[model samples]
Target: MKKENLPPFKITNEILTLIYEIGELIGKISVTQEFEKNLILRRENRIKTIYSSLAIEQNTLTLEQVTDVINGKRVLAPLKDIKEVQNAYEIYERLDELNDNSVKDLLLAHKIMTSELIKENGKFRSKNAGVYQGEKLIHMGSMPAHIPELINNLFLWLKNSKEHPLIKAAVFHYEFEFIHPFQDGNGRIGRLWHTLILSKWKDFFGWLPIESLVQKYQKEYYTAINNSNRDGESTEFILFMLKIINETLIELIENQKMTDKMTDKMTDKNKKRIEVILKYLSQKNYIDNKEAQNLLDVSEATAKRFLNKLVKENILEAVGEYKARKYIKK
Candidate 1:
């Protein structure tokens, strides 16, 4: 393939517009320090991504089981399925270290993502391959002899293409699925790499769990792929993916707004009391409920509620237990 050769896709009006909307939603989020600091939310999103991606490939683990496995608890699912979840987590947690443009890193990712589960882990298939849904094949890959050059050409174009990352990511996803480059784990890896490509454009895509939405629209996801295959271009898939990304961004932004409204939902008096507590904490080490009652000139119960509200909003953290608890800067 020549450097000027681009992939089989078109830049339709809808793809461009969704890209713009996704960018707008992205700009609206500072989210909060909590989104970054809240390890629980991060873990949940990671688990959601792993569960949904594997579920698309017919992995037998439930969401609860995936969570348990990631949390280092024993789950009764098939050992192979459990290993797939583990492998996915391993790869996602190490996202900062992988290069989106390198075929070498792609293979390394495949290796880690399929280790102990597939006989051809880390290597491209030595025979022709196709994507399957249940017992039916939906798409066939290039012949075994063509796999290496096709992948190399794809990557070379990926590095050189001037297309938007959203478009590029979708095209790579469509092409990777079209290539079915590996003997197994193509769907999961294709989705993972699409996210890696976008995460390169925006860091938070790594944790955004677009897979959950894809899982919600699983039938449409495959239909989009099948449509692109039938049409001989990836325009259908690109439109489908850009919409998913836009929807995820809208969801994130709305959730962030709701979290912000926790403060908005406060009564005027409660809001003033919160302001007082914040001011006090700027100079003091911590604020106990007794101190809160005295400073805010309120009853013990009201003062305690205010302090707890601050804690829940992530503006302050509660330390100690029961009557001994104190509120400190988070």
Candidate 2:
């Protein structure tokens, strides 16, 4: 396909300005070392991502509940909602394994995300599905008969387009939602894939928690989509997302600075990430990497890092080794 086959979007001046601002912020954020290799930050970001994405869909599970559910703890929430957090955690954890341009992978992700929740899991709708408000239909998805080719063409345009990844990712997000490929879970999966596209372009985005901001301004998010829908172009949605990306980067920078201010030393900084875990450890007989990982919704490596750091700080003692390794409060 040629450039002419690209989705209908204009590269307006506002879009270009946001792109520049985002670039500058990305540079600053990258150098600030907020998320360079910090498992704690990434873990927090992933939690925010899951919570916000689900929250936008009216999941009603609080952020704390989402974090708890991800760590394998029981949460007093609806079963379907709890399953959503579990499924999202599993999908995001495997971000490294997904190819953003692969339509097959998209279906697989939907399967993982919506299994046991929707009968249309892992497949496009064969019947017309539309966004609803109360009993009133607000927005109708594409005709079910055309979904297969629409998604393929959309992916092709995304993969081959000359636009910046930031713009392409945002445009892809709006276009994906417009197509509304799945009968359910379209909102969550669209946001996940948006993050996926950016993370592929810049690994830092794998845990940026843009959805937290999306959920914050969810009305604007939907408004942008509706505006794009009305105009028959994605420029409005593109502008909206670029602004969100810029703002997210700004928050990351500001947050790192605040984290710095909250600490007088590196150890103090480390301590802040696990105040709860340490308190929880004080009452427990033992805590292992799996338990800590669940407690923090962090990776195994991240959990080990925290535990080893604590041991060195004389706050916890390491016992056993390998799979038998555990930590006890000193």
Candidate 3:
């Protein structure tokens, strides 16, 4: 869409209220390093898990049950090669290691994460590409025959733009999705790299699960892209993403308030137990009896009971065989 025809990036009164509340919750969480760690871990894990599910759902997995596989749950669904998951994890793990705005890092991450799905993973496509809606091509766009030059221009724009971080990220996301740079896995890689760009702009954004929100509004997400294509540019998609960010922040704030209230009512011992559980969770989603004993500095029986109590109270979820059981935050 033309700039003039695009909707204003206006924050409504309701959104402003939600932002203020979210700011307060962010402040509260920032006060405790432990709380911050807990939240960030949950955010990152959920993002990776959801993206993995999305990747699997796109028919890349021949035998694997995508949903169960992504959740780390046991299932009867066929298992596909998990190299994609491994590559994505590697890129995500090294996100902070990247310090420059060069296209190399971006291309490398893309190539590695999508290697299995494309002939040119670390390199740009050599052929003309266009986005399709059903059997018909929707946009009559073509990339520079010199793929590297086109990617360089895109990165330059991304680095120099003074737009709001949210807007910039969303626009880049939609553009990348439209570009469909890779032969396959473009959608997943585009979303993933957009998040990487966003996290680089703001550390707080690294802890926000925008993908989860997008998944919840999957139809709208697709509609925003298709609608924007009917015109030109991605103004509609940008606005939609901004709304999602606002809603995600609001939900996070409400979750924090609930956690605070619940913890506030507990006794010192219970609070300590909760801290132990949260700490364990920060390292990994599931904790077993032996690890809980060491974390809580309690006997085995005591640790088991404590975990059981938490499960009974709906604070934790239990899974796996009895002898090898583990617990995760509910």
Candidate 4:
């Protein structure tokens, strides 16, 4: 095996502080019942993950369009765009099948992620590549002949390193972008691989939309990559990513608190009714006044009141007009 010089990065005060805060946030998130008990919130977060990750790569589909695609509903999109959505959806659906530390599994992920977007989806590039902003070259990857060796060595390092997973994943992400291993889909694959590494260490990361925060701070993301390359180490990029991860966790914790507060405000009778309705909706997807009446053994007027109360509370959504309206769990 060819030995390679893996890029160097170190843990800093900022990194340690961010990691501790992230740990605190994760502890709060784990103990919160809202995320664990509310199926709809989990599903929505997954949709956000898929939508934002693809959007970073210039996929033009709206969040609603992505949701429709995942639900197996047809939408008018370019074939390439639709294929990209489907490919990402499939990759996330089968994330357990990809081993985070396996180079071969990374290749499989590239194949799935870029199925219809590139000619040689799963393979390393046969020619040199560089990151560019319009006309200026920002960073050049290793020589084409060394791509496979560099990647294998990086994974080897990941396997042997004693670093915390948070730091290891950020290092891997920065190095992967620097390596630019594949012909295309490098950005998406790098992001996906970072998520895989974290999720392996802790499963909730499998659903967290870290990419959403990256998309929100895209300029900072690109700047961090450029700075890391300039410094010949991943310190800059690692710190930036650690901060983003902490912020994402804080958002989840605060939102969970708000949701729990809202749920607590409901009357006991309404809370019981809501639980029954959610159970039915899990099977039926949607219910109208008549269906609600039959399911809950309530009068027609009472059924209308119950369904409308859920709609008002934002726990259920009402579709259509008046007598024709139906309610779906939000």
TM-scores of all candidate predictions against the true structure: 0.79, 0.80, 0.70, 0.83
Give candidate 2 regions above 4 Å deviation.
Answer: 1-5, 265-330
Instruction: Quote the positional error of residue 260 for candidate 1 in Å.
Output: 2.0
lDDT, residue 233, model 3: 63
Model 1: how far is 316 from its true place, Å? 21
For model 1 the local lDDT of residue 141 reads 85
lDDT (tens digit, per residue) of candidate 2 on 50-130: 999999999989877887897788889899999999999999999989999999999999999998999989999999989
lDDT of 4 by residue, 224-243 (tens): 99988888889999999999
Please give the RMSD to the true structure for each candidate, in Å.
8.6, 8.7, 5.9, 4.7
Candidate 1 Cα errors over 4 Å, as ranges: 1-5, 31-35, 263-330
lDDT of 3 at 77: 35
Q: How close is candidate 2 to the true structure, as a TM-score?
A: 0.80
Model 1, range 1-330, lDDT digits (tens) per residue? Answer: 223445777888878888888878888877445356645556668888999999988899988788778879988978999999999999999987999999999999999999999899999999877777789987778788888898998998899989999999999999888888898989989999999999899777888889999999999999999999898889999999988988888887776676457557888777667657755664467999999999999999989887887788877899999999998987
Task: Count backbone overlaps in model 2.
Answer: 0
Between prediction 1 and prediction 4, the one with superior TM-score is: 4
The global C-alpha lDDT for each of the candidates, from Candidate 1 onward, is 0.85, 0.85, 0.65, 0.84
Compared with the true structure, model 4 gives a TM-score of: 0.83
Looking at model 4, the pairs that clash are none
Ranked candidates (TM-score, high to low): 4, 2, 1, 3
Query: Candidate 1: TM-score?
Result: 0.79
Best by TM-score: 4
